[model samples]
Target chain A: MKASYTRLAAVLLMALASVALAADNDNHQVTVTVNDINELAVTGGDITLIISSATAGQNPNQATDNTCGLEWTVNTTNKKITVATNQSSFAHTLKVQAASVSGGTAAAEVTISDTAQDLVTGVATTLGTCTLNYRATATAAQGTQSVAHTITFTITAAS
Target chain B: MKRILPTLAATAAIFLSSLGQAADVAILNGDVSLTITTAAAGQQPPAVTDETGQLEWTTLVTDAVKKIIAQTNLAGPSYTLSVRAVNISAGDGTGAGAVVLSTTPADLVVDIPSGIQPLDPGTCTLRYAASATVTGGAGTDNHSVTFTITDQ
Candidate 1:
């Protein structure tokens, strides 16, 4: 009985010593999650406007003519474009138009109300094509000069 | 009896010393991240990796498709980013109006060579390819690709 008791004491002492000498366990975690990405791309890197010389009465005027058509594409929930000009004074009446949309979903279209509108009228994931047209008055500056206008396109998450 | 006790104590001391000799295991914690710095409808210019590296296209465009280049700052004995497994994890589905990415020309299997032992962080660049079939609707869309980075 005494020997059995000694063995039990030895076992308990070893257990306690093992616990004391054991290395502390350290733990850490790394979580990786991917977020939804929204992106926009245009075919042509930059846009160019070509204004040709016309007769005093046959200029590319807003009433009956439009020119400098550009094609752009979007791939986002929604897109809007705003037009501005560097010409402080109005020697010639300049008009900008979102010509039309093609190659997109049925809901895709162009909005041109002299303000910002969807690149493709509605929100969609389809790759649509849009034509941007600019019209200038016939009775403009006499000399062959150039004026700069800015066309800014914006992408949004809204439909 | 006294001799037996001393022997048992010696055995216990030996076992505890062995535990003390064991090395502590450790691991670096954080996220390994990759970002496409420049890409277009059918083009992937280059990508920046937060893992101390950058990625670029091996070939600018092959048959109207752009390649992807991946680089990282991970000091490696060896590094690898899987090719066949590289794919779009989220975004517009890869269906009719979806943009698909691959490591091959036929939109099939592409064998991108892994980085050998790179001395510097951004020295190695792994290339991948991309293709897109855009239909009607137009808007910006986000896409993601998950690739494993192995340093051995």
Candidate 2:
């Protein structure tokens, strides 16, 4: 009877050890998630495209060097920068052209309308500076009423 | 003596049966953990100085995988998971240093809870894409994402 009891105790101890080992093997997995980021910045807000007193002979009143200028610095992380005007038509025709860019290429003289325009289109990952120039065409009817238009800039991922 | 021996054998059998019951009663509590991952690694969008310049971060559901893994030992109880932004730094531009984080399937509220079945404890996983946008000053913007889990 004593020998039988010793065998039973050993079996119970082994069972308990196995259960503890199994519990130790169980794991609860966790994962941390963050997504890709692409950010952009532009210096100088509310650009004043001042086209001084115009003469009809001038046709298109071009802005002086410091008169109508804006600079944009963007980190286009594998994306392109698109430009557009808020409305299809304004009191006066507004034209925007990139004078120079620190990196990549810029659009030639493009008239702003409802449609979107491409300012910078490439996969560049550095802060790029782009110089912009604005021009306006005023008619005798549409005098110096000080018309204002909102220009929108958009960034899109590369295909 | 012979009758006493039979009684001893019967007592031992009863003790062994009790041990078996104790083993069957072993229970493990369920738990869950969540993590946010990105494919772009360390690259972050440039800081904005004005509204015209916008910063955008996008990820496919497969790439971001807002992962949530949960396990349970008992049936009938469900686990709820939710996430949100904790802090945002300052910026001069409009909506600058602001974080607009959103999940696809638009789970603005609590998501579907992980359900456990009878006689079986199991684990469940959920994945989704996250997108964020901010516009503001040219500085290091700070923010955090919070994840919470509850049982119901």
Candidate 3:
């Protein structure tokens, strides 16, 4: 009887130790990754610039529109925005300048063509906004004809 | 001799049963990682999700109801992280909806019925979602997510 009591005590002690080691909680690692994000958009929709009348002796008064704006969100450093138009040849010359620029340096007014031109430079990791000023010029010699331009803005790595 | 043998056998059975009643829980799968890489222009980064992690638990306490709560170690994260329990099996437990994880403990699974025997573990799938915005910028948040099973 005494031996049985000893064995029982030993078993109970072992079981209690096992219970003490049992874990009621567990954990795992979770990594939330945010990759480099560069997002650009054109807001305020389509704009129209009509050159109705021109001052005497000079080219048609340049028609300008500042209704549209460009907004961008870049999470990477050393990025720039480029602008280009679809039409290689057009009747009127179109120029674009980034005005009231934030988070980047506005480039000089660029005469838009088929080749992409830098619209904004020195853009780092930040949210930026700029007003797009478009100017259209036409000489009286060029006949009056409607020309539609499909402009594209892109955010690319700075060279 | 017969009487002594029966007494030892009964004692052994009780000890084994007591050992099996201990509370335990574990994450069966490995850690979960989610990456966000795409978003519309001028919009917040799209939410990313991962469903590869799972939770397994065993509790034999028959006197009270049990539940699972979750928490994260990240205190001030620029982004948002949420988790939910789904596809529960082998137990009577209701999964909670998506709970945005933080330093505070939140209910992840509730109403876990007790009397779950050993070798018959309860399991549930873990779904995690992470989101960020352009204003949040780009960074990585390593969260040590903990799941605890306790009596409700």
**Judged by TM-score, which candidate is best?**
3
* Model 1 misplaced regions, further than 4 Å: A1-114, A121-147, A157-159, B10-24, B28-48, B51-152
Clash counts for the predictions, in order: 24, 15, 0
Tens-digit per-residue lDDT, A2-92, candidate 1: 7855775776577567545433222222112222223344334444444565557675533423333333334334543334444454344
Question: Model-by-model lDDT, in order?
Answer: 0.35, 0.39, 0.86
What is the i-RMS of every prediction?
9.8, 10.9, 4.1
Better of 2 and 3 by lDDT: 3
Worst 10 residues of 2 chain A by lDDT: A23-32
Tens digits of per-residue lDDT, candidate 3, A32-66, equal 98998998999999988899887787778889999
Off by over 4 Å in 3: A1-22, A43-52, A66-68, A85-92, A99-108, A113-118, A121-131, A140-150, A157-159, B1-20, B88-91, B118-120
For each candidate, the DockQ is 0.07, 0.07, 0.36
Reference contacts preserved by each model? 0.08, 0.10, 0.65
Error of 3 at A116 (Å): 5.0
lDDT of 2 by residue, B1-152 (tens): 55555465566656554443211111123222232222121233321211111111111222222222123222221112222211211210111122223222222112212222123422222222222221121222122222222211
Could you give the DockQ of candidate 2?
0.07
